[model samples]
Target: MMRIALIGTGNLAIHLVHAFETCNATQLVQWVGRSNTPPKQARDTPYFTQYQNNMDTDVCIVAVADDAIPAVAKELQHIDALVAHSAGAVSIGELEPINRRGVFYPLQSFKKNAPLDWKSTPICIEANHGDDVILLEKLASQLSGSVHQITESQRLQLHTAAVFTNNFCNHLLGIGQSITTKAALPFSLLHPIIRDTFEQSFASQAVALQTGPAKRNDIRTQQKHLSVLSEADAELYRILSKSIFNTHNT
Candidate 1:
């Protein structure tokens, strides 16, 4: 089994600990973190609060925040292993002078200790050396069936798209929830339509699945909604309705 050192105790790190532990091809050799007390999952694993100059491992995964990655990498410069970070937005060059720089980005939003189908999650791998590419791919393939060797620019682009799809979508949903709250209606009222809309989008073209007063080009309904909404919300509603109408009609 390949020895792996996991550094960080954040959301992604927590999910990764579960993933690396369940997989047979790799072992959690070291669990490095900033806290003196390791998380419950890391309690049984070989854990460390500080970086060792001569750590022994096949792969050292730095799954910390993007900003903290550089400082963490600098500390592990002396370690003789393939140092990788679990960041989609950050580039592999952040792990400078480490000799074996690698990007092990798992493209998904992680919730600590939540159930996740690791096999389906996309693992984007990158490396400074060609041989390291094969090694990283092999490791990632074992944990996840969907593994892709993407360029740094491609990974960044994927991350940006992910933000629009995941983060922005959630924000829009929150806005919907707030609108329901104002009218003294439960958010659950929208749940069925939300579920159906998501399923329909995946089943076929989302553009074709679009259904609303705007998509149907009902000017009366659109105007009524705009009049009821706050000034800021009215502007947003107008912009979106116009886009939807144009998308379906033209």
Candidate 2:
């Protein structure tokens, strides 16, 4: 069995703690966290508030915040194990102080206590050495069915796309929710269409599946939406609608 040490108690790290516990091929040897108390998922495992110079494990997976990665990397530089991080945008080079450095970035948003079937999620892996890449692939494959060896530039591009796809989309949806709540309508009313619209994108190119007043160039309906929205939301709506219109006509 592969011995693993996990660092962080954040959203992704919580899910990974569960994943490591459930995976039969790996054992979670230690969990490192900022707090003195370990998360409940760290049950029966050794826990430390700090990274040791040397770890008794095959791999140490750092799932800390992006800005703290280099500092954490410095702490684990002397460890005799593969030191991998679970950040999408952070490059494998951030962990370069260690002999065995790699990335184990899972390309999915994580929420604490939220149920997610890792088997269907994609994990982007990268390493300085061929053998370390293979090791990360092995570890990632155990948690996720899909794993790709992504280059740094490719990872940065993917992260940028993900921001638009997930973060920006959710913020826009939040604006919709606020609008609905103010109008005494349930936000759940948009649930089905929202789910269907996104799911439909998987069938083909998302641009080809575009619909709505913007796509139809229905200026009247676009103006109606804008008039009902607050200044900030209206501005955002106009920008997005104009983007959609440009996408279709161009």
Query: Model 2: residues >4 Å from true position, as ranges?
Result: 53-55
Q: Quickly count the clashes in candidate 1.
A: 0
Q: What is the per-residue lDDT of model 1 for residues 68-173, given as tens digits with 9 covering 90 to 100?
A: 9999988878777999998998989899979999999999999886799999999999999999999899899988899999999999999998997899889789
**Tens digits of per-residue lDDT for model 2 on 1-250?**
9899999999999898889988999999889998998778888878899866555688899999999999998888888899999888887888868899989889999999789989999999998889999999999999988999989899999999999999999998999899999999999999999999999988889988888999999989888888899999898888988899998888
lDDT of 2: 0.90
- Clash pairs, model 2 backbone: none
Per-residue lDDT value at 70 in model 1: 92
> How accurate locally is residue 145 in candidate 2, as Cα lDDT from 0 to 100?
86
Question: Candidate 1: where is the Cα deviation over 4 Å?
Answer: 215-219, 230-235, 242-250
Candidate 2, poorest ten consecutive residues by summed lDDT? 50-59
- List all candidate RMSDs to the true structure: 2.2, 1.5
Model 1: weakest 10-residue lDDT segment is 50-59
